[model samples]
Target: MRVPLRDTVAVAAGVLAPFVAALALLPLRTSVTHTNLALLLVVVVVAVSALGNRLAGALAALSAAAWFDFFATAPYQSFHIQDRADVETAVLLLVVGLIVSQLAAYGRTMKRVAVADATHLERLHGTTRLARAGGSSADVVRRVRQELVEVLELRSCRFEYGTLIGRPPRLDPDGSVQVEGWVWDLERQGWPEGEIELRALVHGRYQGRFLMTPAPGSVPPPLEARLVAADLAAQAAAALDEDAVSAARRS
Candidate 1:
């Protein structure tokens, strides 16, 4: 498996950075207070945490604590500390570094979620605009098919007009999956085998459905994405209903 370059850099830095930093401070050990030295090591931990993930941050914290004990404490170059204050400083350094790493990880997670939400909104807006453009019903169906494939991470998607066939896993508007009259644990089990159906309805009457074949071994899409796909299907059904009404009036 190919590892990401960022991760490789992070891991290397996490292990080596504390040693380099502590050695650099060795010359000033007699002049600098141990508390001040510990704070500097904490800064090194923070930098590694921001540059990489939680694992990288944790490695940095551990490295920073171990190096601080060996290089900064009494009996120079020895892990044993004669002073109680120095030992406390080393303990606090490790604890603070760990807390900072967890916070950094949380911040990264929130950033990713915000980006995903924005993309979902754009998909919905684009589909709504196409449906309102007064284009042919075929055009709307085609556009929706493309969106469904992307939003659901499906291998393929197609529109089926009128009449329900054999029962398959059904994607409800609420983003739950129903199979054989039972609710499938979609989030835990991923998509079931075979095709799934997302029905398009107007005022309780069926307009059509999109038969979706999920990509094998693909992670089940999040609820927010599934909801957006359902909304897109509703837009397609509304457009088709309007086109049918226009044809009847013309005749």
Candidate 2:
């Protein structure tokens, strides 16, 4: 796969920015304290972390430490640092840079999670609104089937009415999967081979089930997402039950 232009730029900057900054500081080596120089390099690491990714940030940190030892410390033009204080400063620079990178990576992860949660809520809200609007049963089922494919990241999904034919992996309301007779650890392991079942029930009545086929080598969705899918299935069942009641009254 081709890398994004922005990422390529970031990685290049991460590796080179520290070297450039250290060279610029060469004249000030005699005037500036070693601790102050290390702090300045930390700033470069922070900038790289903000612009790029964790790997970029880490590379920046390593580059900064190496250049600092070579150009700014005693035994100049070499990696070896004779001064103990300079040695401490070099080690600290690398440590601080790594920590900043990890924190940046964590912040990015939280942001993605927040966006995903909002999307899940919208899917649930839309389905509930449609059901309340007196939409047709087929419409409700169709909408739910589409939503399931998205929420669960399934390759394909279809609804089956009435009797369930055979034993398949069942997605429970609590987000646990019952396979054969045991619960599968979905987090560590991805979806099992073959089709999975998501049953839809209304007031203890077996309304229907959704047969979902997982994509080959697809990552397993989180528990929260699985719960949202189950909720959507429930909405479809409720819509079907409402239609059944209306037909019975007419008869």
For each candidate, what is the lDDT? 0.88, 0.89
Candidate 1 structure quality by residue, lDDT tens digits, 75-118: 87888988999989999999998898768867876887799889
Tell me each candidate's TM-score. 0.73, 0.75
Off by over 4 Å in 1: 1-83
TM-score of 1: 0.73
TM-score of 2: 0.75
Candidate 2 local lDDT, residue 89: 89
Clashes of each: 0, 0
**Relative to the unseen true structure, what is the C-alpha lDDT of residue 155 in candidate 1, on a scale of 0 to 100?**
99
lDDT of candidate 2 at residue 109, scale 0 to 100: 64
Q: Report each candidate's C-alpha RMSD, comma-separated, in the order given.
A: 4.4, 4.6
